[model samples]
Target: MPADENTAAEATEARRGRGGRGERGGAAARRAARSGGGPGQQLTYVTRKLPVYEVLGEEGIALIEANADTVLEEVGIEFRGDAEALALWKEAGAEVKGERIHFPKGLCRSLLSTAPSIFTQHARNPERSVQIGGDATVFAPVYGPPFVRDLDGNRRYATVEDFRNFVKLAYMAPNIHHSGGTVCEPVDVPVNKRHLDMVYAHMRFSDKPFMGSVTAPERAEDTVAMAKILFGEDFVDQNTVIISLINANSPMVFDETMLGAAKVYARHNQATIITPFILAGAMSPVTVAGTLTQVLAEVLAGAAFTQLVRPGAPVVFGTFASSISMQSGAPTFGTPEPSLVSYGAAQLARRLGLPFRTGGSLTASKVSDAQAAYESANTLNSTMLAGTNFVLHAAGWLEGGLVSSYEKFMMDVDQLGMQQRIAEGVDLSENGQAMDAIREVGPGSHYLGCAHTQANFQTAFYRSAIADNNSYEQWSSEGEKAAHQRAGQLARQWLDTYQAPALDEAIDEALKDFVARKKDSMPDAFS
Candidate 1:
């Protein structure tokens, strides 16, 4: 094709890509750019504009902190089979009794002072860099689900293709800030080598900041190496590029794998979210206070250990505790107990002065039904009010996190935009006051034809992409599709129309070659 014809086609595609879900991050710059509208054009990062709602009073906070200290000193926590970690604990002035390390009253808290309260997680595209901690809340999609569901209502094991599609959808969803780690577990890919593919997909498809692998110590190392290739090793060492998740085994246990991964990330000054996986009544005591004590102790141990690995290493104090159904022994979602735990955990994290990570749009419904909507709404509200800094599973989570629904992904993305609007709070600026418009339209006159109303019409009201606001007769005339169905349509349309952010050819080739070499060196192990 001729140069002119090719440019015309590119412009057409760019136009078709416009007018997506919500206001993009850099819309004016996107329109002025000569190149095609790429993912880099719009990076929607949410900064919390609302005040935090504290659930625990000062006395409650003091009591919890005191109890947490007692648990650490008297009860102690176990570092199973991690001789190196135990040795480090011993060197850090903790009393080491075999694998169990007992801290003195304020030992862990003293060590936590080394971790930075806030840091930037850089993306391949610098515009998409995210500030973790303080007043920012970065929204990431559903992570680590082994199964996937499509628009056809089919449920099955996720494939590499499905994983790539999810990446594309995440890239397309402007509301999602980070391309999270393991958007879905690609079952078709060998267990030993999926991280390579996952990281490569994130690097290639999206320009957003993404999570690093923590499945194994070596996997975390591979993630760093790949990041070095994308963003030079010197840049990566000085700047926090990837934030990895390190889970602690509940009931006061720190597994070797999570510790090893944290060690690797901390060694390079990368950020790690030291999280405690708690299920009340099962992994923890049924009461919120008991669970809060355990959550604090576990994070203090894991996060403090990261500081031991490298002082001033960036780490997020994370909480993922939920209640369980006693009757069926099943995990519940969007319940009161989890909200209380999340709120209290946020207060505890603030008290310790560390960045916090929690869940979003959490639900246990098998499909994207009424239960999914209400549950997700409740979860999102609690997370926002709790002032979360990094939100994982912000969208598409379903069936107690066993599956990621395509429709729900879109639905939750829309809701996330709504949350961002809500967090912005009511504007009080002169323009926002609308006094002139009110005076101009006073005395039996409508504001619809006023200049202020016309001026602010585009942005004055929150526009929903998947919501149906038509009359009942008009909705029935248009087939009366439900919210989930409309979301499915938007999901499919986004996938079909998705254009991956352009990467330099040399860098893209180098990343692919590196992934291939790493995969070839590993044996296929499915366990």
Candidate 2:
């Protein structure tokens, strides 16, 4: 029997049982039989519990909330070209003028009440699953880059092969928690049909949780359908397996295409990140406070819309705030203003009891040079401090999001290791204190040979694979390769050694057939 048929039979059995015990037992059995169950799988990297750095006090938070509400009621937001969304808003007691939606004060917040404070996002490999929201920060790779930087330092339009390789890199990297969506745009693939290939690549190349398609409503449907085939319809319905990005057309607009994709994910109870893509002084206000207010208002409207679609639907309060350099009309990243805005936005999300998403290893540097290193580190530190739950572009970001550099990807992944260790903080357990080692070593003796040091030496400290920690003489003896050189070597090494996770042969065949049929049914359409 098909999985859905078995599910229906189990439901019938539960209904006929005397108590609810049989029903609970049936549910337990179904969960145990969930796909992706296996042993000895690597666990996804997660942040240990730590205090989130808050830049905003009570007054600042209140002022931002008040300004956001003002923007909602007085300024209003546009849900352009989405009639159903406009109608839904109207029925929900909002004043709709064409595509613009004006909500009464407190309505958006009230609607957001049903959204879960934290939710579990399952992966194909059960051990790779992650808890998104709260203090737990989930790091994902760079998203939506259209160009790729090769090891030989050549930049070109990304292809389907480049896409698959990035997926493999994400799979092999222990730091990245989610496989992510649109690692890069494959210019060689048709716009309409590319989503199918992207989803297939993620399904076959990585076992980590990943985002779903949001390019069009049909593509979003395809994502759900494909997920159903892999995880079973019942499992997909019961658990949040996909976390799709639903970006808001900033300056108070939500495009029809994005809204349509969001509706599908919301209805299915899959997670969606409601991000306000703001470039301060360009897409939003010039001031950080002003930009933060707009971000809050846009996210509030989007999050509320998700709840209206399906109450208790998992939604992330997201912000993609950057600044436009006054000297040039270019967008800048890892600047002080965006960091401040991100800090406040996180507080706002916390105030509304929603998960926050923002910050990454963002940089406008063209190469993996010193500028790239500093900028990337600045953003990563901000995200870690602000307690961002889902960090898109956590690694591999380059040239103001226009390219994904392989060398930078490896270097950033290594830095993410440092962040993880810092988040773990100081362990004060009896063993961690190392009182025995101190006593054994006494005043001036070395503790390297002590029992405690010998026992815990392997895991004692973070060892950097990218950074050279050798003495000057030792460094001179060996070729003094730069960080990027070492990182490039590591990137190529990972690609050379990566092995795709094992999947059931029947399911793999089904996935391939589904892709072939879907591609055949649609003519290539480029937007």
Candidate 3:
């Protein structure tokens, strides 16, 4: 298509995407972007707006753009680990030596323009829907290192079993919509085998849209092979991978691993989900606006690279921004930064007419205490309200998503259910919210068994577990437990009653054989 035709198509689609549930982010964003709007209106939980960055006004956007440019120039990524990757990087105009491959700022920036902004991944249970490059919830549990201590006070790592259980939980989790499936324990499997194991678990547990981590460039083909094995020879060709994640080091730089993976995934028509995080007041300019501009720049440069690799290869804009705690000097997420950044990034994604991804139930909280509830509530509220289509770290997160908790998993789901209710967004249709029932009661009479209420009670109110649904005496009799306690109990019940999915006898045998073969063939990695 000519440049003019492409622009025309974008313009037309942008207009058409404005009013549906999928475009909730688009609607709330416009409302919040209005100048001089009241603080309440701009608050992410109340309406769709960028998470509240300390930087207000145009400066925030400026910071995002500037940082992106910095990344392109001084911090270009290079692949130095594997021969195939090195060859590809060099062919792609990346400069390299030893274990690092680099690229030109201009080339990096150019790729952002042509990347495909939308793609799809069909789920086995058609009821489970995920639109990778659209406006809808596509949540995945947190990935990366684990740092939380268990009841024994021993620090737990992300082992293969841990990865499998997490994937299993993700399968059972009602709100956790995506899987960073290869979530690994640093030592459980060697880098190469880990991807295969992760993919194997995913193919067995679910036929959902998932992704491969670009933690290392050398492992890219292994991840791709997993896709091939699961979906057959045309996996990449069928666009079954949907989207692949590419993480850009914040402050400034695209590491070799992430960049090369982006190229490989894009070659297959998979969307590249690239997120550049700025530890505000740390890796980023302290000012909120300045940080945003930098963050945006980081993402845009990568988006451009994705476009260059294969114009219109599916890509979803990702924003992972957090602030530094002045007292601790450590980065803090699950705070206002995650939401604020999500909001701003969604705005930018809208500006570009692409799907947006953001964090959820985010926090820097440790235990599942009040702090956990507070942080989780705030982040999830912001993401759903902002209409983020791809919500990451949505459940099974504890200790800022570094640890998985069966307990916290259910808690997050409960919280998400509440948010979904809110997003169901005031059913004020003439007969929707049951306004007629309220009017019939007319300011004082009890509507306990009113005809209208009898007909529509279920639709009229927000229900809850520890949400105070009883008289003082009734409550006293049950022992007033806090919301978290109720949530905790619910988690236990699910685990106790949960039936592990039964695999086909032949399929199960195949899986066992595969693991056994991997263990035998690569003792160091699998054993």
Candidate 4:
């Protein structure tokens, strides 16, 4: 079912602080606070232990140092963005060819030394959840790919209405915590105004921490400015509310826009997540080692910029990357390379003492199908096992993350629950409820009528939603629809029925004025 009434009511209760058992009193809160999970970051599966790294143990540090040397020497990265980066690398005993710069082994070691392992992402909505250090996972809204299926089912280019509607849908979503939106369809906001809309969408629809989609240099500056304005001047400088994610163009490139954005965040000691999306056998070499060499080079290059721009910037070594398909020659989302890369990334990120951003629910298919489930589940499993600190696309991605499908959105929520169950790891700390209940009636005991079952049932075991636990006859009669159908329906209903939180009159007016001024300056973008 598409977010049944119980789910809706549960959501309501959660908003009002009543439904779940998340609340904690004095000692528990203090203990939880003392935990390295961080005040802003809460692990959904707190009891579930991820495989921790021994970065400085034995020869691990030496291994990382060796790897850095290899990356800079043999697996050297080439940059094709600003001449400044090239000049810097060339001065550091590197090669310079036009805009492309080959990083030296010494530079890589120096750069890698400055990165960190765990950091926090604070939300604008104090009530909303933030994540870091593999403690919690994040679900981002769909983006990029153009075109939509109209009411009559004809595929056509998307418009501003489509963007706004998608934005509205993202804003209305119950489980998703961040709104990755400019939400203005193909109407196309000017490169700069896109940042404004993204910031504005977060301002209007969510109090949650949102991603700033700054596609270029000027836009990145605008984005940082907006954050400083929305929050206090010291806010972005302090890694609160807004955290900037900069993707280094793979196969040796650091566009000015990305480098510029990294500069802003790094200068402020705010968060900067450097990622690379490489299409294997295409943009990257076909072989895994070749891909890693190229990817590691990009990482080091970004690390160099980050440290050079400002030392000690709160940076995340994100492996939000995927490989390409050899057959179709397009990017492949659901594949083994992402998992492998994510694992290696986690190991490397740990060495930096920085949090890792890994993959999740990524797929090549456009809609929520059986293909979607298989791919997403496998990806999630791999990332979680890899001890990834932060998970992107944890929930709600469909049509290869190009188009948002509500059906898949809610299903992802359910999938998250399932994954959390894995982390729950049998719950041996359930006060021995299972055995006690079993012993309550001896070997032949019937616990169904026992007080243990009556009182501690909810905490005693694993539960499933997408999977049927009912009798086979009942399941057969119900006519099973894949989780996608259920998710799609939920997305539609959320768009149609869910209401956004009220905004302050003054803030709303200011936002409207901001949009108007921007729109006037960039009419070409107000699609």
Candidate 5:
């Protein structure tokens, strides 16, 4: 056998040997502790033990930073529609030319100094709260998909029911750490009023941390009001109970809609993830280096704006980098260049002393097929290895993010469990050493029946919930099923068995009343 395989076999054996008949009860207890005594009992997030894969050297990073500073100083960024934002920039020594704000060198960085490097987003269930920075990595489900592929393989516009279902699935998923915002856009609900239902669904169906609506400034205000209802006003005021996404219009622009929402969240002491939604060759330069410079410039300006709203607010440096097919003008995922961008961008975020968000199980495939699997894996793996702190769209993405697939969600969740294990790195404990088992088994003899093996076999390896490893004859006897088919079955089973975490009666009633009054106050506008 090759050395690496041989080493892996030995490590597996050692891990298995760490337990024995005497340790069985302790092993079970340990398992319970790790799993937080079953789902929904205690919320948990991954703290990576593996070293981050850094593709850029110090010189490369310096070059990118210098270029980004030049872009900010020379070209400047346009702040359209928000005069208040422009005024603040001018007040802070930036040269405001019409709507464009020319930031002096080191201005954004100085402004970001007050932003917290790490902060906790308090879930209604305190045990479900997550740390969002440093070594921690939190996984949130797919966000903002307008369509969904149901269990039967039919794709259709997502409704509020579909939205709630995705929230429930995220809650039940052992690997999903956050109940993501806008899991899929509920087109059935009026555009003006859907945020109410979406926020309420996350509050009602799941106890995990969730994102706030940023569609409009008033909608963001509504989200804060509702959050105050769920979590007390004082708690909401003093703590970060919500984290919202604020995307910059790529190529050096920050629209008023995003700016307004960002100000609302920042002023309320909530978190704002400033992401540059860049599609290379369209929104950004085709070269990875060029893209990195632009991403850094955009993130710096947006994140700095949050600090300007409130000095000590929490903010995340986020980027969504993907390439476009030059010939077809369609976005591409899981490519090498995007991975490089992710790695480089992560380094930049770290250098700025802020939490970073990037990467997801992204794919352009319309269905959960081999193409989807390969593309999603490429992006997902890079996301983890790049040391991403907060991950949005960690699962269920398909059709270049236009649709969320039920089967793909489950498959991605299974892969997420693997990522969790990878983040745990290697166990160097005495049990993991397995010296006693090795001594007993000696050379050539198998240790399968040994006491340690017998005791630890159940938990020694990450048993995939989706992959089928059964023999061909057994597989044929049961009806051969593709991965998507198996995943679809799992999704159905989870939804069937899902039991929502309890909420206080008063809080639930208040949330419902708030939604009703808000809806009644506004006439439904589909657009």
Candidate 6:
């Protein structure tokens, strides 16, 4: 081994030795528990035991709903560049003026009645399937970042290898339940054909439920066909195997691309998350209430369109709300205004009886520094308390969603493990009372040596994988590495140790064949 590698190994061994038997045992116990039931055994998704925090009272919620209705009835939302969508609206009793569809007072809500309040998105490995509504909180990795900050802290355009590495990282993370779509845009692949590689990475590298391509209608169709080949045609048609994102162009418009993708997913009995991408001052009103109203209005139109395509189809009411810096005209994240918007939007989704999707570890910092930590914590806390059902961008976001940092990804994964612990709430069982421990260890004596303490010590607290809790002397003696440095080391270790889940040979061959045939059918389009 190299000198540096030998030094790192020696330091790690020294730390383990100094941690004592209890800490070493705890770490071993956690590892054993994770691997006990084979893959997908470590908690599939979080079911929150704590009550959801609500910011809007009855009157406040009613006011926002009324304003959203007025926006739909008066201003109307445009279904741009898709005459088929306009025709669907017209046929469904919505008044079509050009490409804009003016809905009646209760049209969208009534149409959404057929949508399920909760549904399961089936993974190729059934054990990894996730419940995406109600008390469930499913964490997926970051999506749509064009660049990556590598282990050496250099930023560059993301490639297909980076995409697959992210998939492997997400699969290895116990708290990230879903393998996200477009973890980062692979610039090395053709824009028109990259979805094939991206989707294939998700299927081949992970067994978790994943999002689908929605960049174009045909790409969405290709996703469905590939899913059919993997899961079988009849099974794919009968169940919700793939869930995709369909973003409504903010300020009340559903562009042709999103509209077309949504229709394709809906018609095939798949799931779609109808999100309105909003920036408080630019795409929406600056005020929280105004932003909530616009978000509801946009989600209503987009989700209602899914039901129109196929009644009883699953859909998630999603919002991506941020505020922009007034001076620079750049997007800002982890701000108070967007947090308020998330809270209000959650209440709105509940009132409409739909699954809500929002919030993540969002930040605008160029690297995984103090600023990134603070911003990501703020947003993640709000996301948990606000009752977000399906959290996209739950990890690895940086530089205003432009770059995915490897160190930040591991840091966020550690935080997500903490969130999982928080969601468990307090335990009031007899064992949790600890009266026996108090009795055994009398006043003035510590419980560290008590029987109860020994029995429960291993799982008593959440241990952060990226945090260094050793003495200052010990830290300095090792290397005095910063948190990001430690996180980078851990990320490298995980990638080195990652093992792709078992996949059937026939299914794998079929998926590859489908991808090859589809790529051959179309000329590559970079734009």
List the pairs of residues colliding in candidate 2.
none
Instruction: Put down candidate 3 lDDT per residue, 158-246, tens digits, no spaces.
Output: 66766766676565555455655444354556765676667667666654457765655445655565555444344356444546678
Question: lDDT, candidate 4, residue 468?
Answer: 54
Model 6: per-residue Cα lDDT at residue 300: 95
True lDDT of residue 432, candidate 6 = 91
RMSD of each: 6.8, 7.7, 9.5, 8.1, 8.7, 9.1
- Tens digit per residue, CA lDDT, model 6, 27-101: 565653432211233566989999999999999999999999999999999999998899889999999999989
TM-score for each prediction?
Answer: 0.93, 0.92, 0.76, 0.79, 0.93, 0.93
Candidate 2 per-residue lDDT over residues 1-527, each given as its tens digit:
23553454345322222111111234433322221111112335566667888998999999999999999999899998888899889999999988889999999999999999998887776557788887788989999999999889999999999899888888877677889989989999999899999999998888788999999998999999998877878777877889999999998999999999999999998999999998899899899889989999999999999998999999999999999988898998878999999999999999999988999999999999999988988888999999889999999999999998899988887787778778888899999888988888999889889899888765577666678888988877877888899889988887886767777667778889999999999899877
Clashes of each: 0, 0, 40, 17, 0, 0
Better of 3 and 4 by TM-score: 4
Better of 4 and 5 by lDDT: 5
C-alpha lDDT of residue 314 in model 5: 98
Where does candidate 3 have its weakest 10-residue lDDT segment?
A: 36-45
User: Model 1: per-residue lDDT, tens digit, 402-472?
Assistant: 99889999889888877877887888999989999989999998989999988876566656777899999
- Candidate 3 error regions (>4 Å): 1-110, 145-155, 182-192, 433-444, 465-482, 500-516, 525-527
Residue-level lDDT of model 5, residues 1-527, one tens digit each, is 23542343344333222111111246544553343322333337999999999999999999999999999999999999999999999999999999999999999999999999998887776556788999999999999999999998899999999999999999878789999898999999999999999999998888788999999999999999998887777667878889999999999999999999999999999999999999999999999999999999999999999998999999999999999999999999999999999999999999999999999999999999999999999999999999999999999999999998899999998888888888999988888899888988899999999877987776788767678899999888877988899999988987887777767677788889999999999899999
Compared with the true structure, model 3 gives a TM-score of 0.76
Candidate number achieving the greatest lDDT relative to the actual structure: 5
User: For model 3, what is the error of residue 436's alpha carbon versus the real structure, in angstroms, after optimal superposition?
Assistant: 4.5
lDDT of candidates 1 onward, in order: 0.85, 0.85, 0.59, 0.59, 0.89, 0.88
Cα misplacement distance, residue 132 of candidate 2 (Å)? 0.5
lDDT of 4 by residue, 1-527 (tens): 12342343234333332111134556544443323121222333222454542223436445545665676666456565577667666666777767656566577657656655445455544445355554555555554546554333344566655565565655444334566543334534454455566566666655556666546666666666666555546445645355567787776667787877777667766677788777677677776556655666677678767777676676777666676667777777767767776666677666556677767677766666778888888787887777765566666555565654445555665665555556645546656546766668787657788877787554345343344567878767877644545445545655675445555455466656866776677555433
Better of 3 and 6 by lDDT: 6
- Residue 512 CA error for candidate 3 (Å)? 4.9
For model 2, state the Cα shift of residue 146 in Å. Answer: 0.6
